[model samples]
Target: MTDSLAIDAAETVDGRDQERGSDFARLSRRIVQAGLLERRHGYYALRLGLVAVCFVGGWAAFFAVGDSWYQLLVAIFLSLVFAQVALVAHDLAHRQVFRSRRSSEIAGLVAGNLSIGMSYGWWMDKHTRHHANPNHEDHDPDVAPDVLIWSVEQAAVSRGLSRFLGPRQAFLFFPLLTLEGFNLHVASFRALSRPSLRNRGLETALLVVHVAAYLAALFAVLSPGKAVVFLLLHQAIFGVYLGCTFAPNHKGMPMLRGAERLDFLRRQVLTSRNVSGGRVVDTVLGGLNYQIEHHLFPSMPMPNLRRAQPIVRAYCEELGIDYLESGLFSSYAQALRHLHEVGAPLRARGSVADPASSK
Candidate 1:
C-alpha cells in the first residue's frame, strides 16, 4: 500500500512539473516584487507587546495567588503565555520578524531559551530542515521516530514498545502530546550538551536560569501539593497547546519517501494542510492556519500569510494541484484518521498472533 501510494504521488508530481515547471519560481518572484515579503513592523510590535503584557500579568497573578487554589488558574494562564512567546520564537527562527539575521537570532534566544527554557539553536537546526523538506521520511524531524508513527513505512519497522504502541497510536496521540512540553525541554538540554554545538555554555546557562526561576516562583507562592499540581497542569497544557497548533499543519498531508524528487511548489503544497478559520483562530495559531502559504514562503511575516493565501490557493487550483484546507476540528480528525489507517495492517497482524508467542 505504501509503495503504491508513493508511486502514484511521484507520478502526479512528474506530470505536474512537466506542465508547470517554472511557474512556482516565477510566481514567487512576483509575490516578492508585490511586497508580500515585506515585514509588518507595527503588526509584530502589537503582537510582541501583547505577549509581554500577558506573560508579566501571568507571573504577577502567580505571586498574588499566595497559597490559594487559584494558583492552578495562574499556571494555565502562564502556559498560554509561554505558547505565545514560543510562537514569536518560531517567527524569529524563520527570520520572519526581522531582516537582519543577528537581530532575529537575539530575539529567538531571548524568547526560546530565556523565556521558555528551550534551546533556540536546537530548534532552528531542526525546524530549518522541516521547512526545507516538509514531510520527507528521512529529512523532516517533525515526523521522525517519536511517540507517533506518521507513515506506514515507519509502522512496518516498529519493534518492542513502538510495535506495541503502533496499532494504538491514533487513540493515544493527544494524550501523548501532554508529555511533549516535557519532551521538548529534555531534547533542548540534550542538544545543548553535544560537544560539537557552538555557544553551548550560553544556552545551558539560559536554560538553567529559566528552570530555577520557574521553580522558585512556584515554590515561593504555592503549597507543596499545589506546586506539584501547578507544574503538571502548566506543562501538560503547554504541550497540548503546542501540538494543537502544529499537528494540523502537516500531519495528514502527503508523506514523501526519501527517493522521491519534487519541485519546490509541489513539494510544499502537497505536504502541507491549512486550517480555515477567522481572526481568533489565526491569532491563537500564530497565523499558522495558513500552513500552505507559510510552507511555500517560510520567511514571510505571519500577518502576510493570510494575504498570500488567496493568491497561492488560486495558483494551485489553476495548476490542478491539490490545495487542502479544512476547519480546525476536521483537520485534526483527518490527521487522526491517517494515523489509524497507517497502523491498520500492523494492528491486524498483531491481533492474529498466538497468545503464547507474546511471552
Candidate 2:
C-alpha cells in the first residue's frame, strides 16, 4: 500500500509539472513571432548604436580627458558597450536572435573580431556541443574530466593534474578552451585545403586592420601609455561582464542527462535562471538577465523580456518547475558562494569517488 501511494504522489507531482510546461509551450508560441518586427529590433538597433558611439566616443573621451578618473569612466563606457556587442556576437553565432545565417555570421564577425577575436566556424562547433550536452559527465566538451559536479566515482577520477587544478581549473582552463580565434587563424593560415578559407581569411584580414587602426588611433589621440591604458582598462572590465554573465547561464544549474525529459517550458526553467535588472541594465545586457526566457526563445527580443516574465511564470507554475529569479546583486552573490560549494576539490585533490571532497 505504501509503495503504491508513493508512486501515486510522484505521478501527481509530475502531472502538475507537465501542465505548467504545457502552459509555457503555449506562451512560447504566442511570443516567438518571426523577424525583427517587435521591440527586439529596436533594442538591438539601439545597442548597436551605443557600441558605435562607444568606439567613436571612447576615442574622443581619451583625447578630451587629461590624467584623471575621467579616463576610467570612458573605459567603462567602452567596455560596457563592447560587452553588449560581444553578447550580440554571441547571439549571432548561436543563431539565437537573428533571421538569416549570413546576417548573423556577418554580425558575429564584425562584433566578435572587434570585441574579442572569435572564429566563426570554430565558435559554432564548440558552442553547439555545449548546448547539445550541457552537463553530461563524459560527452560534454564543457565538462573536462576535471570539471566534476558531484559523484564519488567522478571525484575519485579527479586525481593527479585534475586534482591539482580542480580548485581553480575553470579559471585557468579558460584561455585554452576559448581559443577559437587562434584556432581559426591557424586553420586558415596553416591548412593546405583551407576549409574555412574565404571566411577565415576575411576575418583575419579584418582583425589585422582592426589592430592597425587601433594603433593609428592610439598614436593620433594620445601617447603609447594612454593607448595601452585604454585597451587594458576596457578589456579587463569587459572580462568581468563576460565571466559573470556567461557563467550563470549553466554552471551552477543542474545538468541534464539529455534533452529527453525536457519540454520546451521545462527546458528553460530547469536549465536556466533569471536575474532582475533595471530597464537600462536589461537593455544593455541584451536581456540576458532574464536568461530563462532568452534560453527558451532566443528570437524573443530584449524589449519584450520585461513583458515576457509574467506569462512565463504562469507556465512554470502549472508545470511545477522552479522558475529561478532574483535581483542582480543577489544572484551574483549566490553564484559566488555556489562557486566554492561547487568548486571545493578541498584537498590537494579531492577524491573523485570521495564524498568528502565536497560537502
Candidate 3:
C-alpha cells in the first residue's frame, strides 16, 4: 500500500503521464526548480530528538507525580505530546523525512503503532485515498457518511445514530471529537482482521504493547478510579487536539461530486484550503495549515511547504483560481457553518413532524 501511494505521489512530478501544456506540469517544474521537495534530514533529526525527549520526559513526570491529582496535569501535557508524535508519524507516512520506503515504514511503525497505538497501515491506506482525491465525497473517507454527515445528500438518507446526530453535528462537533482518540484505537484494532493489512503480526504486537503498557502504567501508579479518570482525560484531550489540527484543512472547502473530472492542479487547489498563520501556527497544525501545497506535493518537507506558499499562491492567481486562505477562527466558523447547512433538511423535517413522533 505504501508503494502504491508512493507511485501515486511520483506521478505528480513534471506531471508525468500528463499531456503537454499541463498546468500541473508547469507548477511542478517551478516547485522542483525551487528545491521544495528536497529531504531535510538535519531538521528531522533535531525534531525527532526533541520529540523523543518530551515523550520520555512526560512519562517520567507522570510516574514522578505518583498518586497525586496533579497527575491530571501530566495527562494533559502527555496528550499534547502524543499529538506531536502522531504528527511525526504523518510526515513519516508521507515519506517527507525518509526517502526509502523501508526507513519510512520502520519509523512509521514506531511512531504510529508502538508509541500511539494507531495502525500505520490502516491510516496510510485511508490517507492515500484522501490525497488521490481530496474532498471527493465518493472517494475521500474523511468526508464519507460517518457519525457526522458532510453533505446534504448524505444527511437526507442518514439513519440510526447518524440521523440523530446529523441535525446537531455542528454544535456537537468538538464534543464528539473528545472520543476521536478512542475511536482511532478501536478502528486500528478492528482493521487488524482485514486481509490486506501489511505486517499484521508486527503491527498487532506493537499495538498490544502500546495498549498494555499504557493501561498498566496508569493502574500501577494510581487507584483504579483515578486511573480511569486519567485515562479518559488523556484520551479526550488527545482526540480534540488531533481533530482540531486536521479539521481546518478541508472541512469547509469545495466538495467534489461523482463524475466530476478535473485536472490535477484544479482538483487539489479548488478543494483544499490554507489557514493563514505564522511559525507557531505552522508548528501547532503540523504544517498542515498549508493544505494546498501539501496536497499538491505530499512528500514535500514540512518546512519547505512554508517557503513554497508564496510561489504556489502567485501561480494560482495567475491561473485565475480562487485560492482560499482563511484566518484560524474564521476557518473553524466556515466549517461549522457548512455542517449546519448540511443538516438543514433534517432540521426542517423534524420541525414539521408530529412532536411525539419526533421524540
User: Which candidate leads in lDDT?
Assistant: 3
lDDT of 2 by residue, 164-229 (tens): 655664445344333332343454334323464347677676666666776676566656787677
Q: What lDDT tens digits, residue by residue, belong to model 3 across residues 204-310?
A: 99999999999999999999999999999999999999999999989988888889978878888999889987999999999999999999888898999999999
Checking candidate 1 for backbone clashes, the offending pairs are none
TM-scores, each model vs. reference: 0.92, 0.71, 0.96
The segments of candidate 3 whose C-alpha lies over 4 angstroms from its true place after superposition are 2-11, 14-21, 355-359
lDDT of 1: 0.84
lDDT of each: 0.84, 0.58, 0.90
Model 1 agreement with the true structure over 114-195: per-residue lDDT tens digits: 9999898888777877877889989888998576788889888877776778898899999988998999899999998677
- Find the 10 residues in a row with the least total lDDT in model 1: 1-10
lDDT of 1 at 154: 89
Model 1: residues with Cα > 4 Å off, grouped in runs: 1-21, 355-359
Tell me the lDDT of model 1 at 265: 84
For every model shown, the clashing-pair count is 0, 11, 0
Worst 10 residues of 3 by lDDT: 2-11
CA RMSD, predictions in order: 6.1, 9.6, 1.8
